[model samples]
Target: ETVIYRIYYYINRSGTGHLTLRELKRGNLIDAMLHCDEEEDINKVLRYFSYEHFYVIYCKFWELDTDHDFLIDKENLIRYGNHALTYRIVDRIFSQVPRKFTSKVEGNMGYEDFVYFILAEEDKSSEPSLEYWFKCIDLDGNGVLTRNEMQFFYEEQLHRMECMAQEPVLFEDILCQMIDMIKPQLVKTDYFTCLTIEISCLQDESYIMLRDLKGSKLSGSVFNILFNLNKFMAFETRDPFLIRQERENPTLTEWDRFAHREYIRLSMEDDVEDASNGSAEVWDESLEAPF
Candidate 1:
């Protein structure tokens, strides 16, 4: 029944409280089904219909839901993406700042919630993804990300870097880079003074509004630098091969790339475990043969 309801909910995208034939056709689901037999890769289809994508998402949730209760708590979510997220961001997520949880378990995330969280995390460049993180960073829910709010999130990242013995980047330096990257319309002045002099002492009342990020492609990188250390480092020391992949397949989305990578990783882990079990069987058989 839950599965049927989920299908109905996704199919009714118009949110007019009713499902229409036009909306169903707009999904292009029939076209996809007509071509499914011709394609070898299941993930090539859109996420809504892709079993491989669902497999990857479900496996990730299963790994995090260690108790097998089919619900994720703050600790479980904290372990997500190799702990790429900070506590503050996780708190914002639980607070339902971005979106309310469909799960009524109180402070826990269900599979549906996990689905939304994973999609937003993997594809920060998308409009919905942008909105999700934007709201998370907007502490006061004022629709703009103030300097203080951004700093609130980044302070944890700075402390994390220090704890790991990595060179800590000052918030002032990051603020300058962010301003330059997004190029938010601050009073036109020599912002480069931040580079030549101590920017910490200077008062630059710059705020990053949602429109600024919506106009820039580097918005995802900005969010990563603020909260997700793994992605930030990956962006800093970006792999040439991954860059080539992106260049080669411009049609594939960030979420698509992430799901593909995770699917291969999960499959490889399963194969390794099977191989280990096979080896154990061989050793046991040899012992029985007195060799």
Candidate 2:
């Protein structure tokens, strides 16, 4: 038995009476039905009424068991068509939903998931830089961050170093500044204790002596220097002496007390200014304060 299915589409335009699919295809439709003031106006109407509607009808026909209506089960046709139509309507509605609302829905997930995902994908071959540390700290795969994991890692590393050595060297203020520069999102949390420990471990000579410290401690200001200098040096292309000289010049304008302290202040500032306002230029160590 061959089933012949007739698919009908109807379009309602304001100027003319209702237009049927047959009338449209045959060019027998009234002048008012064909009359569109602009090409865009006609295209929009055709897209929604003819093209999209035809696609929906075709999908429904494809899902049917037979082509002949007489041989087809009436109840099954109604059920399948109605189900597909319902889903299509739902997709259209969701597509139109505002982005702000969608983001709010997605934002409820745990931050740990976000950080972990990022860490898992990180490239190990690249230099073990701050970005590498960042990938590790992001325990969850999500791009947005939370402070607990990062602070815990930093604190644990600091504690390990402190346990090896008896005294502190890194200044609390300098540690806070480093946190601000390295992980701004994590800096917002009340986990400054770990940051303080990291700075102390880095600065204290006695602590380094306890572990048989092998690396230079005073290469750069605490705020500007990376904790893993060895990793940075591995990939750096510049001359080692030039880099060392830059760090050695205590009188350099950028290393000045105000430069270092001001950098810290800018990172901690709650009300962020626009980029156009220009960040305080890197500090000059040589500029003497009037005081």
lDDT of each: 0.77, 0.30
- The TM-score values for the models, in the order shown, are 0.79, 0.21
lDDT of 1 by residue, 144-185 (tens): 677888999999999999999989889999988888888865
Q: What is the TM-score of candidate 1?
A: 0.79
Worst ten in a row by lDDT for model 2: 1-10
Highest lDDT: give the candidate number. Answer: 1
lDDT tens string, model 2, 1-291?
Answer: 000111111122121335556556654234434443344443233322233223333323334534422122333333442332122212222232211111133322111221111121122211211222333333443332233433433343344337657343344443454444333222223225344334433333212110111122322222112222222233233568645755787444321322234335544552354453647444345732211
User: Where in model 1 is the C-alpha error above 4 Å?
Assistant: 1-41, 185-205, 278-291
Error of 1 at 170 (Å): 0.8
